[model samples]
Target: MNSVSYDAAQRITLGMKASDCRFIMDEWLHRDAPCTLTVRRAKTKGLLCVVADINPNENPDGLYFLSWCVQHLNSRVKVDIKRL
Candidate 1:
């Protein structure tokens, strides 16, 4: 599994709307395999965790789109990609 974690610069909402997740799953990542988005509160900031079965190195464009989608939602957020 591969995961990307986003840490927000400023405090924001703790969770993403279901509609937004649906948009990402059904619209943005529709071509590739499905993924999971998990949102949590980190102290005063927000954290978004994206987990997918695909390896990011093998699909840079998909990763880019995923990152873009997250950033589009919250510009203040920065991403940290991880492989597991």
Candidate 2:
């Protein structure tokens, strides 16, 4: 939770509802394992790519928020937060 910039206040800034946030966390816990989350922009098309590697020992909720923020910023962007 502390690792991520998104929280109750940040969630409002990001235009995310409480329920939506919960859903994303749940999905992340079950689908995406928490690890290192990275967001990079493509030099050519100016698109962002979010990549997250799975770390079972890491904080799942924090990684979930990171993943959610990455995707929320650009749905079309790539995401690779899977079990390792």
Candidate 1 at residue 65, lDDT? 66
Q: Of the candidates shown, which would achieve the greatest TM-score relative to the real structure? A: 1
Instruction: Identify the runs in model 2 with alpha carbons over 4 angstroms from their true place.
Output: 1-36, 74-76, 81-83
Ten-residue region with minimum lDDT total, candidate 1: 5-14
Per-candidate RMSD vs. true structure?
A: 8.5, 12.7
Model 2, 36-83: lDDT tens digits are 434344443534444444333444465455656657646433333222
- How close is every model to the real structure, measured as TM-score? 0.42, 0.32
Cand. 1 TM to true fold: 0.42
Local distance difference test, each candidate: 0.46, 0.43
Per-residue lDDT tens digits for candidate 1, residues 8-75, read: 11111223444555665566546564333444434433333344333444444545566667776674
